[model samples]
Target chain A: MAPYETDDSTRAEDADDLRAGPRRSARYVVPVAVVGVAAATIGLVPALADSGNPDLPKITAQQLIEKIAKSDVQQMSGTVKITTDLGLPNLGGLQNSMASAAPRGGSGSSADPSSKLMELASGTHTVRVATDGQDRQKLSLVESAAEYSLIHDGKDVWGYDSASDQVFHSTAAQDGGKRHDPAPATPKDFADQALKAAGDTTSVTVGGTAQVAGRDAYKLVVKPKQSGSTVGAVTIAVDAKTGMPLKFTLTPASGGAAVVDAGFTKISYARPAASTFRFTPPKGAKVTEEKDGAHGDHRHPKGAGPSSHGLLPGMPGEKGAKGGRKVIGKGWNSIAVLDTGSKGGTPSASGAKGLGGMLGSLGDPVSGKFGKGTVFSTRLINALMMNDGKIYVGAVTKDALVKAADTGH
Target chain B: MSRADPETEGTARTARPAADTGPVTEPAGAGRAPSPLRTLGLLRSELSTTFRRWRTLALLAVLAAVPVLVGIAVRIQTGDGQQSGRGGGGGPAFLTQVTHNGLFLVFTALAATLPFFLPLAVGVVAGDAVAGEANAGTLRYLLVAPAGRTRLLVVKYATTTAFCLVATLVVALSALAVGALLFPLGDLMTISGTRITFADGLGRALLIALAVAVSLTGLAALGLFVSTLTNSGVAAMATTVGLLITVQITDQLPQLHAIQPYLFPHYWLSFADLMRDPVYWDDLVKNLQLQALYAAVFGSAAWARFTTKDVTA
Candidate 1:
């Protein structure tokens, strides 16, 4: 006990002496300073990367639109990152349930180009895109341990899924070169869509100059004039020198964050190697050759079941609605109403029952002048599926969808 | 000092001579920095001591067995002819391809173990690096042996890093061997669906293994920093493992996506990008940069803590 007391007193004295030495304290200060510097650097880097919005020549929105329209700098390759947060419930779990509910050997479930497109509707995805011209382009959706590549070389279009080792091949004449449905939505695609949406219903103005993919660009902000539209604004960063859309962002009216943001992280305008567009089905891969105009049929091998249409199983007003689809309004406030023929008690009415059940779980039941139905709402789009087999879908609020449904009915 | 009295008395018989000898041999230059050659020798000794432990061998054995177990399981599953229509099904990445080409087993096993097992093993080794020496009362002796604190810390870190490489290689080589034995090896189908020769595949596998080892270096430094904060080896190990799991969980949460990129484990799976035909280097570069940041930050922190730390233990 005496020895322990003496040892405790000595340890206290030693600690005091150690603390008293300024040089010893300085030794400790080095690490603390290192940590401080590291923290500062970590915090500083991203801020610095985004710090100075590059100064560039100002251009009007009209000139920018004309420039994008006339820009023909085709031969290029780049990496695009797309992030979409529609405030939907975990779509991964929902996709699993839908896949399970889909029938075995169902074309709508998996291994199809449309199913791959459905994967891009949520979360973040990295896409590698190379375009030699209109007829020769390659887009690869880069997954963690797999890739889904859609290569369009002249007349031949090939879609390859590495994980499944499946190849989907089609000719340009057969599918009108539109079989690249699995390709991720690039900034150019979104920018084109947003530009088309610009009209009397939208106010297009040049916002500011910024840097995107290390290229100075001018921001073209497009805001819908209608109050019912769910979209707050669409901002496209057009490369100042080339007029190429380097970034596209779509924010919701009640946005905390953009619902859809896609931009090139790296870009090169140089012509891609010819080999980039060439694709051959690897050995052991199952190759499916799509016939003329049969892409729709091939995608929905199990007949024209209503649920088997669109990128998702039950998404309304997509392809295959054909003649029954009608636009209820123009521009941003427009709603598409699809007559699914379920109300007439057609033989294929039971086909949508499975999809209806799934939608029932995802959507909330609502009643209006159009009668009882389910309303599925996302951050930027609201879809109201009527009990009478009508689907009202638009980038609008739930009230707008309900109102559109009532008026159309 | 009173603390020195007990330490001297406790190890008095042996420690007195060692303490006296350090000054007697280099009387005028006792405080001078250790030569690089001496530091190299100390590093060699530290590596030998660490690898000689039965626990390290057991951890390595467990890591080696992971690939064997994975390969055998895959072999049995496919042998039953039940593998049809199972492509792209949910499992470890590259797992479904293992049956087609044996080389894929290396990738599958690494992916399966990387998220947890490999890092867990590293955490154990690095967590015990300094604290274990202190717990065994060898830290005071090592320091008094005139092994400067900075030099000892550097050696300890290097040894832990060596363990990381060894553990990762054990898993890779074992996987390669098992993969060769259980399945046919041939042209490898990359993530881009392009075929590369077996040699190229093997080269990529080696690169992937190296990337995985480099990934754990960050965690090793982190564990070493935690070790310097405590004298209890078990406490340090538990704390490191706990931090690893917490960070992993945080990385998974969608709400924390803003900060996930800064976490060590966030980009661990980016090694798979190497399997791409064109080889996407974006995420891989981010991972390497993040790891280097962690190493520099934590390595300096460990050095500082160890240098000024009281050697009461």
Candidate 2:
């Protein structure tokens, strides 16, 4: 160590010389080194945390499918994180438009199950889900400061929004406990959708093993054989022990980030407390009860429940369209054409107008033998809403949507 | 200006005698390993000096008043019976709940201020930590008091961190008071729509406040580094605050989403997770880790600059 200098002028000169020397430059090396270490840690931690693919006993795709079908481990609770990147521009603006255009009286309220489904279409959502048996379940959409919870306990279904202090409740008609409102899609629900599509039109292959939510899992990769499908492949991580799907990822043909990725960050096979499914409206909460069969018609204006695809409702081969809804083409290339105002009542008519306006602003105008319409295209789904009140929607290109419309199915 | 030379030289010579006498005579113990007791005394004095300033008090007072304003405004809005239409569609998180339970004001205020007000106050105090002393020419006297540069820098950072805690508590306590006074307090609702007892709500509020204070420590360290870079207190403060605003704006821009998570302010609102029924540790842990990273990087930079540079002031 250098001796302390008493003379001011000499010490000042020494300071200036030090500033010009290598020692001054060397002093900065510590912070630079720290930053370098931080960057390295940031890059390495995720890589290390991944721990690569877990090794498991090889199983055929058919065997894995059978495993999922036969394995019955019910009553579980977990935190599911769902991320959707559909290449939509300005999602905040889109949400604002949807909120403003949403009908206040009927199915557009914040507590409405369908509106809740709309909220899940974009951005990342954390959902706390607990299910006990087939009839009782709970799903809570956790936001930063607010929560929307849907609790189904036997015949009674309750939806509560903490922020609004509003509750939507309905009693299931005694027709063997059929739930009208769709629960938020868990990995299991998405896996079911992917597996349902795994027929002759798709090739199911075992893609090795994975560790999901700290559990050993087998990865099932399902790829569409038809080139017309926008979905390149769907991968589901099935728990080796329980056969429950722990993660579901859908990659687009264009190939960037997965368009739909739903995975459990934490899970427990232990049955959730029965009290978790029970709900009583808080004091001062505005409770609205839906009459039997009324919620189903207005809530699902497109005649398809959110459970059909877990994201965009009425995807290819969705059943239960009552009237004016037709499926054109076959398998992955199929397009669903709906006559919006035909049997949808006044609320649906108004909703279609607002939706048409919103989609018109978001999409590009196209014209062909199908006449003029706005073609709203995402990475995976293209929706062409014609001026004649018919909507042609499918997981295909804009040209395919136009061709589907021209077929006039 | 001409007398500065002799004055600095005189202080330097005087400091040597103090160093020879050891830790017994000087609290800062120049030229020797700093004693823990005297270092604590130095820290105490530094904290007193920082908190006693009218500027600090004014910043705190402003922070304390924000929750009151928000609470009263919300009270007035709900009093009009027009809240039904608005629901929880807009505004900061937990704003809608303040009308039902006053305890929510704490969460609302913290969320309201975490992005800007709280960090701005932290910037002001931290940016002035060392630069203000130098600008007043008290730094030379303190150093000549045989306060080693490293110890002084450490004391300065400690003082800034104390301010961060004090500032956050001021906001939280004020919100709690205003909330209790304005709205009915009872069982609180978690973000998961589950009910929690009032005592549990109060405990969570404290944890949230602590989390908020922890979040600002990174910015405090960055500000302290900026303070060491210049002798002008106002310049340092301005630069720190300006950097804060720029980072916040960049964090919000969609184009910069790739780099937004790396920014210090990115996960500050993860404090809201404490209000969840089963607290989500993912973002909260990330926030803590990110703050630790920033603190380490900037803290070392401040130490390097303060120790190596000549303190002619």
Candidate 3:
């Protein structure tokens, strides 16, 4: 100990050096910390500003709804990104089924039925949507160089996929008669659909303000009141200035990410370029003319989820033809029960026969509040096969489908 | 010879005529080697050492050849000019449009290479930078050149960075040349569904190239730090590339998504935003910011290790 001990002078000098080491290193540490913090702050600015919007005017749910209902915003264009995460295995077959079941030659499902159906089946997708008059609008899914576009110009609707070099044209029949025009399945249209169905089924409340598409928006949350449905809530971001619904997100009662997160990433009130509404198939493109009747009659009720088939007159099984769909419930949580079975409609018309016994013979039987039923679930669509032979399906949860089955008749 | 050495050593020892005369003045020449490094001299030396190697040349050649092969394949596929939209195929979806407008070839080439090839090249260059010199026993001499450890490391990093810019530009330029030779170059349609004049498109292409080059800065710094860890250049190169692929694979996994944003390659595709009509800058800005974060963290780590490291190799 005596040999190891340094003299008082030397010991003090060593102590000084030890203290100075950290003090000197503090110079670098301080700048690094400051720069790191600065970089992080800059990186987080967008998210923070997005999450903490201060200037938005607070309003009640009713006032927001009234504002949305009365607001008029036509001929607007923006980039909309849609993401669907249905907790299902493979979405490929489901996408095909949805694409087939979806109204043809429309933007209801996506701009490109085949491609966008596959693209949005799992992950995120960006599409450009623009609407001019009641009779004119365009939805273009932008690919790298190739684009798929569906343009409705007054008298004619066109579906053009540049990648596949195919064009689908459908002409509206001009009967000297007034007819109800099915609104394009845009975010606004979807929001309006949900809002219309918010009667006894949902509890509407005003949520905190959020910044959506660089605009101040008041959040309107609509939660289904009845536990009969598996719907957790439907959140719509109503633009404060324009009163237009800028974003619509639906989360199932069986929670995960939002099932449908369709929103405008960028939006503008200015009129879209007129040329966007017009489409002439490029030279050498294969053209196919589709009869208007195939998709003309079906109107996707506003809140009918992503797939609405109220217009399909006959059930698939009932007529031995491919077209038939039964929609249960109303509003943003409606489920369309489609019978994709090769045979015409289900064997039992009335659901009096316990579906559990019949569906047990078909699909894998899964039991819940809806009683015994064969359950087939996808990330985006859930189907409950009842013994009554009705396959209840929608973007809602299993419970919602069960409730629909109980009340669908 | 011994008497001759002393005679010459006497002049070398007397050269300074200072209190500290060396015993072996002829060979020590410690005072003679402390020449102040000029910035241009440092850059020239770095460029020569890096580019003169066969490995570096091979990487560049491979990079340049990619666009050429892509251009030829595109030309062959669409010779009749009746091709439909791009299909699920090799290269980017933009490659399908090269027949219509050759200028898209540049974009196609960039998209094709950015995922792996470009980053791999950058990793190789940066990984070999400091470690290779150390392995070759040239690091001690380089440090002795009065450049200081910090300055020498800076030069090495700067050289690797220059290679990044060059590698990206090479792919772009070769695509441009092949594109111009094969297809007509004119006004281009942007991904955001907007039309841009040929001149403006060229400007955007250049910016995209710059963005892509800057995107690799994080990887460059990471590889540089890895290089500082060992004396084996090959080992460093392999480790850096392996880490690059691992980070990339991790980024793709949905389970590890919470940490994906911090990964180096997370924002590589943000350059596509530049091709949009109004240009979406959110992800692009984040990409730049993230890269800067990586550079700062890893660059500081490299400096700390390098300054304290004993040059045993």
Candidate 4:
């Protein structure tokens, strides 16, 4: 005890006396109680907050799917953020190969899209989009203040990049006025992709309501029945009032966090002004005119399933696009398998052996019901390269892919 | 003063009073000690004493200057119309847009400092809380005052917490000023991909700053416990900062993923979730709860050690 603590000396004696008895134990009761309550609440809050959706009316999976399929809310404009987290090493050589494989000299694809070869090319990008009906639309990818935008009015399409000071122009033949078909695929057409043929491989369920893009949304969860797939589940948040899809998340089958998340942070149903679709090339900008077939439309045959190509479409004679690719299964669990040897040539100087060795070394080799394959995964997309030349790719789990390979052939 | 009050200890003392024990001039009450008002006075003095030190002032000055330096450097890098390269570095990607909307500077500065500088500053202050006083031989006089050990410990912690708020606010305010000076302030896009009004954006920035401060609570308590372990302020500060860096490195190791969630800095970056539209609350809620868990565990440990600690310099 300090000499100056004259007053505390006496109290210290009392504390000592209390310390020898139940009074000392009493000091701990309050703190212990508080900790207990806190621990209990911590354990309970997330679970409680996760379970209920008071605003959403109960509906069967079939009815909800029907509602989603029939939703016709068009002429909406909003900003969307796309994040892809594929857990793969940064391979500069792979990026170079992918970039050189594109036809238009790597002009207006995406930022280092050569790098986008692996969904493991993890990044978050912002796209601002406006669509009036479908034929007239404009979408811009904003990087800082610079914008890479694509504008299509009727058959004329222009892609402008402010940073590169370049514009790409192409024209598509107009559809016969008498024909009746679904609108041309707009830039923000994820809802259509998510709801497409979901009944095949997915077991649909209604989840709790959430507020997305400042609107009330009901969750529509599509869970894959196949066990081998890496995709745990696909969740879509549909606007309760307008029936428009506002958010889509794909959680990997072996979940840690969402692999791919695409959603509107803000949205408005009101049609964008007519001027939003117009673009005038700035002075001194370089202009490139591309042939009609260069716009990727030639790859999607009429009545054919969605193109099985990666985000960056393969150009003519490009080894990637030349590979014979086939889809196995259907819906969210579907796997796209490609015979990479079909190009009848080895990859750049790296050679098929080097590329194969590199990819194999980068990915984990797993032998399962589907035999041996090397799996490269991120949060969203998983690529399984078999010992043979066949490559299986999907958002499904590893086992699901193996099963698909076993049954797919 | 008579010793009839049950609250006063009944122990006997044999040592004589030490000299130069300033601030003990207040006369002892009859059978009572200092009033609540005087205890509050102790808190005020504690805060002033902590904040007024040259080291503390230097820490705050560095924190305040970080935003200005960042803002100026970004302004120069982007230069009027040149498309800024993708927001470089590990900070939130939106930091690149600071040139377009200065308001983002607040977020940028926070993100820039949270990983090392800010936490380092916090570790320094918290590490010195008790050990510094004891090192300077003032702790004996403080404990000798009517302020009991438990009460004084609480005051020391409260003062450190108050420093947390001041330090965060200084960074934010400096960034706000520098942002307004260097770039346009208007509706800004959020991480959720939605546009929010400038006013609302500012409000969110404030919330983010608060969250950033709160994120350090667990570390603050941890440092308090370390401070109680030694009489040398330097050792306490070093150990606290060593723990922080080690945990940060360990959190990144893939093999340690199972234990990373329990780390204090694991969710420190969760403040980015606030910038999203509809305001993602799950990680934010988890962060607060984790901080609470840390506070409870380490705070109790600090109390248990500090209460019975011998004050000898």
Question: Which residues of candidate 1, in runs, are more than 4 Å off?
Answer: A1-31, A90-92, A100-109, A164-166, A171-184, A286-322, A341-374, B1-34, B80-85
> TM-scores, in order shown?
0.84, 0.88, 0.75, 0.63
Instruction: Encode model 4's per-residue lDDT on A1-409: one tens digit a residue.
Output: 2334645542453445445575544545545766687768867986776564547777776776677777776688887777755554565566445443442333433322221222222466766667787577666665532455666777766666443445566664556312111122222244455455355556779887888777888888877675555667778888877777788776776778775677887688898777666655543334567643433433322211111233212111122233345666555556667666554222221133344665566678887666787876645556667776667766566667777778755
Q: Distance (Å) between predicted and true CA of B217, model 3? A: 1.7
Residues forming the 10-long window of minimal summed lDDT in candidate 3 chain A: A311-320
lDDT of 1 by residue, B1-313 (tens): 2322312122242232234323333453445443556677888999999999999999999999999999998888778655436655677888867877888989999999999999999999999999988999888767655444666787899999999999999999999999999988988777775667899999999999999999999999999999999999999999999999999999999899999999999899999999987789988999998898889888978876776678787
- Give lDDT tens digits, candidate 2, residues A149-174: 88888988888887776788877666
Ranking by DockQ: 2, 1, 3, 4
Q: What DockQ score does model 1 reach against the true complex?
A: 0.33
Per-residue lDDT tens digits of candidate 3, residues B13-40?
A: 2222122222223343355432233545
Per candidate, native contacts kept equal 0.33, 0.41, 0.06, 0.03
Candidate 2 clashing pairs? none
lDDT of 3 at B193: 37
Error of 2 at B71 (Å): 2.5
- Native-referenced TM-scores of chain A, all candidate models: 0.81, 0.84, 0.68, 0.68
Quote the lDDT for B66 in model 1.
96
Q: Which stretches of candidate 3 lie over 4 Å from their true place?
A: A1-47, A50-62, A75-79, A90-111, A114-122, A128-186, A200-203, A225-227, A254-257, A270-373, A377-382, A393-409, B1-37, B84-86
Question: Residue A42, candidate 4: how far off, in angstroms?
Answer: 4.0
Give one digit per residue, the lDDT tens place, for model 3 in A17-65.
3545654344346337746786678679866776766476568889999
Between the candidate structures 3 and 4, which one is better when assessed by lDDT?
A: 3
- If you assessed candidate 3 against the hidden native complex, which CAPRI class would it receive? incorrect
Looking at model 4, residue A231 earns an lDDT score of 61
* Candidates ranked, most accurate by TM-score first: 2, 1, 3, 4
